[model samples]
Target: MSNLNKLDFTALEVSGRNYLKWVQDVKLHLTAKNLRPAIEEATDKPVGEAEKATAMIFIRRHIHDALQTEYLAEEDPRALWVALADRFDHQKDIFLPEARHDWQHLRFQDFKSVNEYNSEVCRIRSLLKFCNETLTEEDLLEKTYSTFSASNIVLQQQYRAQKFTKFSDLISVLLLAEKQNQLLMKNHQARPTGATDYDDGTRAMTGGSRNAFVELPACVIMVGIWVKDMTDGRKLDVMSLVSEDQHED
Candidate 1:
């Protein structure tokens, strides 16, 4: 046999357990014998050959794109936006042929667990579909709004403030929170780093023309006020409520 065809099946280091599990999962999703063929065919050649690499890349992209649909079901525009931001800012690294400074290079620490990362991959793709929608569908053309109860203000605030500049950062924060919680669980209850009560009042006005008033934390309030002061037209009309009773009056 030629040198190219002389590859040994015994030496090709495929994980038997993982390979079996992966095959089972594929069979569950797709009736085709994708895993069996993939494995059987691979036995005749080297794993990282050019054709195999290309195929692997294609499969990874398809899987990553499919996972991003989760945020759509939530119907939270901001959440969807965050999901896209997460993919662009975090998860694209593994699939991208080259790394760019502008594009986020996702790190291991950015995810709490592999499961969370996998979930986010799906979420980001779903959000991309939202982004690609027409202006009307995006709420720029036609909007919707919902009012929250007085008790929910605290929750609204916390949710808005915790949203990072990029969805990736937000995911990183969550992962960090989860990791810290785990540490706390292991040791006696000790607070984690960068863990703060991010209670700031702001809810998604949805499709409303009324700009969502996000009353940021004490640290961000001054920055918000400064930005508001500089704006000429109607600015983000955010007000601080010192106490719960203040809403009653």
Candidate 2:
């Protein structure tokens, strides 16, 4: 008996937009059970009773109602799979233009972390590939570099000086830089104020001379702007601001 428990097709149904990926998942599960040939092969050759039964059960249990009504009546799992693919696969055609628009306009915002920004780039790339559009590594690298926030000047300069054949390597280096910058910022935040005892046994208070302007994190600044905009320029309480930042994070 095949371990059908290992595959849960319910999670694979993510609407028409993800139909291709869902079909791929179904095929992989079928292959694992030694039943893929029943649906994938063009031969009219009969499969074992067990294989045929298993395929039918899997398909009926997993497919969405919209797909099942149209395809399941065929009673042949292979035909049903093909019919579903033919119907829902046109989603890429419908979505390609919107995806392209998003890619062209996408940029790293001050409020987003390096990881978050990188993930969005990867997502756009995947969507484009699903629509039968391919972007080379060079294209990806250029897109990633061009989308960085204006605050990331040091990183932009460092990356520009080096050549990376792969986007992953560039992401790794950027993530490391981001981590180091975060540590430095934390240290700066924790540094002591300027009050010290001199050798003449006099205490000197240099608080007045110390810089009072503390640079806020980009995310915090963005949150403040958002709150102000949403409330029509009304200021929020400190706790409310803190809560909003927590939610955003």
Candidate 3:
């Protein structure tokens, strides 16, 4: 009843959880209308109706994908945009309400039996947890892939390839390399005061400072020239003196 913004985040973690619960409640209410049809399609003994269960699976995937995209970017717009666009086949509007509606209307009609329905429900329940919803961690683990995201997998690769003198340096490197580069750009302002101390110290010790990863992407050729200057004695020789003077006369 009181203003939620007035509450301290450290002491009052309930608001965030409540808000997500509210959203999920609304989504479930809207989607429940379609569940019977979906179950019917998935459970039907006839092959014609049974094939329709695939549609239900697709719908569930869409719902999960939408929630993950929405929640991931809710705090970081840039990352949200990047994740929604890249992860969902370049679809720019993953958060649209229409998507939620379409998912709600999806139907499945054929499954072998109650066991199959239970099995599918188990899978769906795990996926729902991975999205921003009400589910236990144990429930999530039941899924074949508990945590699935293309960006994360790629970042893992980048993290593996990086070589840093310090652990933080490697983190910075991996942050920039990930396709969801936006994730790194968010919550940056909330970083602890000492988080950058190592980087700053390194820069000062070297007498030069540059965020090589962020900068190189902006002007790669210029970076090459800068590197050349640094490596070649910090000098650029246009022509030396002029062997041309002797030849011109």
Ranking by lDDT: 2, 3, 1
Q: Which candidate is the best by lDDT?
A: 2
Worst 10 residues of 3 by lDDT: 7-16
Candidate 1 per-residue lDDT over residues 75-185, each given as its tens digit? 332233244444444333332322222113333335557355536544443433333422222221111111223555664356456533444444455467668878878
Q: What is each predicted model's overall lDDT from 0 to 1?
A: 0.35, 0.68, 0.36
User: Which runs of model 2 end up more than 4 angstroms from their true locations?
Assistant: 1-15, 44-46, 69-72, 191-249
Tens-digit lDDT track for model 3 on 1-249?
133344222111222223323333433532454433332223443333442344333322333343534454243322332333344432213233333443343222243332343455444443344343444433322221222245456644554454334433443443354435456556465575335434654454333434432233321223113222566576553122122332453
Of 2 and 3, the candidate ranking higher by TM-score: 2
Ranking by TM-score: 2, 1, 3
RMSD of 2: 17.4
TM-scores for all candidates: the values are 0.22, 0.67, 0.16
Clashing pairs in 1: 67-122, 68-122, 68-123, 68-125, 68-126, 143-207, 144-207, 157-200, 157-201
Whole-model lDDT, model 1: 0.35
The better-scoring model by lDDT among 2 and 3 is 2
lDDT of 2 by residue, 1-249 (tens): 133455575433436666766777778888898888778766777688688878888876676555556554687777776767777788888878987998888876532577987788788888888898987899878877776678877777778779999988888987898899999898667644332223122111212322211243222222123335465878665445544554665
